[model samples]
Target: MKQIVTHADPDLDAIVSAWIAQDFLFQAHASEVLFVSRKVPEKFMQSADCLVDVGNRYEPENYRFDHKPPAFENRNSTCATRLIWEYLLDIGVAVRHLEGLVEITYQGDTHRNSEALKQSRIDGPHAKLKQLKAEYKDPTEIYQQMAFWLRSYTKNL
Candidate 1:
């Protein structure tokens, strides 16, 4: 299936990055995929199969390319990650949370808090995650806890 992504601004990078990772997973499974974005940077363009510019069209209703209706929405300060996460969930992609973060890995690869873990000695959030890890024997349990937290987090938004 062709996956079209529309970017309104640079802030959507993280969501786009996660989608790229998901594309990689799909490609590994021998699925055909395409990425379409407006005003995409050179770095991102290199990774995309097709690129289009929607120019000054802020209204999601006015957007249409390849004859497909655009899936557009305003994102929180985190940009499109939350919207992307919600879309993935709606589509039935199984995502598990880890330490209050959403993670989706089709292969053995996983999202790690390596940097956060290292910074834990200084940062409060990382320190809390570190403490949680210390208290739990199974890392999977942490993911479960994160899933619950994500539900609460999204609900309050």
Candidate 2:
């Protein structure tokens, strides 16, 4: 396997990486691609292989930011995560069964600068897990729910 790291804003990086991963899967004719990240963009759900949330806490440093629930119409972060998981599962990717943490290393060292170091700290996957747990009795059930949804969505596609 080959890895290509690029310098881009967080959101852009997520999109580009997801896209590249999708292309890799197509080129390699792989069953699925696993996307490991602390936070994944909403737009990448269409092409993701597996959306893995490695961090035990969603935003360890910024829990306050995610404490408040968004409006009913607003997107729920955990739901978004489940959506990607479901999308992949529908296409026959056994993502939920996979066990491991996803790690992403930044391309350059920014710790030398205090401001850069501060900017580097952001939320992790744990936040999404917490939110999902609050909504569902068992977080593991999300996998079944996602699989069901995937089954429905892929029928037409």
Candidate 3:
């Protein structure tokens, strides 16, 4: 089974990146998602099939996607979600249905002040994410719920 690792108490980017990996990258294959600390443990670093948003590394060929400093300092407008999404497209995966999802994720990660973002902050996915964070202490539960929501969301987009 493929093992995907991301940060615990995952934010939008981390959850969405992992979701993309599970739903697209590993489609038709069994996979497990693990949530770790911001400083990913060396165990996961060595054993995880994919590391997203928390590895501090951005080597797509290696399936390690992160936009943190030291490795991706110039990727100010991109986040882990965008990297994984682009990787899917590069690998010939169909993700045209996800363009809006990816764009909103990028906007949120980069803190772009747009009317849509502002409205989302008020009562959209962003608001739902915040509500989920406040309600659930378990990261896995949060990811599961968000993954379900994202699956439904993309079908509509």
Candidate 4:
């Protein structure tokens, strides 16, 4: 099975990037989501098929997507989710419809205030994510729930 690794207590960027990797990158195969520390261990660095929002790496050719410096010197404009989404698009994946999702994730990750993002926090995926975080202790559960919700959101969009 393919493994998509990310930091524990994953935020929107990590969860969304991992979700994209699972639902799009490895759509034809089974993938496991593994939560590790922000400082990813050497074992996972070498073993995981993809690392998202962690590992401090942004080499998409190697399937590692992260926006934290020094991986990204200027993180104000991008995040892990956007990096992964763009990579998928480059590979001819049908993900143009997810541009909105990618934009919101970028805004949240970069702490950019926007009317659309603010509205989303009121009742959109952002709201659901906050609720899920409060309701679940396991990060994996939160990711799974959000992944399901994202899949639905994508389909309906």
Best by lDDT: 4
- Candidate 1, residues 37-124, lDDT tens digits: the string is 4555555444443222222222222212111123333211222333344444555555434212332211101223454334433543
List runs of model 1 lying over 4 Å from the truth.
1-16, 23-27, 30-38, 41-78, 102-157
Candidate 4's error at 147, in angstroms?
0.7
Candidate 1's displacement at residue 19, Å, is 6.0
Candidate structures ordered by lDDT, highest first: 4, 3, 1, 2
Q: Residue 152 deviation, candidate 1, in Å?
A: 24
Candidate 4 local lDDT, 1-157, one digit each (tens): 9999999988888889999999999998999899999989999999899999998889999999988888988867589999999999999999999998889888988889788799779987788899999999899999999999999988977
**Could you tell me the C-alpha RMSD of candidate 3 in Å?**
1.3
Query: Which stretches of model 3 miss by more than 4 angstroms?
Result: none
Q: After superposition, how far is residue 15 of candidate 3 from its true place, in Å?
A: 0.7
TM-score of 4: 0.97
Assess the local accuracy of residue 130 in candidate 4 as a C-alpha lDDT between 0 and 100.
Answer: 96
lDDT of each: 0.34, 0.30, 0.87, 0.91
* Per-residue lDDT of 139 in model 4: 94
Ten-residue stretch with the least lDDT total in model 2: 101-110
* Reference-based TM-score, model 2: 0.25
Error of 1 at 156 (Å): 25
Every model: Cα RMSD to truth: 13.2, 17.6, 1.3, 0.8
Clashes within 3 Å, all models in order: 0, 6, 0, 0
TM-score for each predicted model, relative to the true structure: 0.30, 0.25, 0.94, 0.97
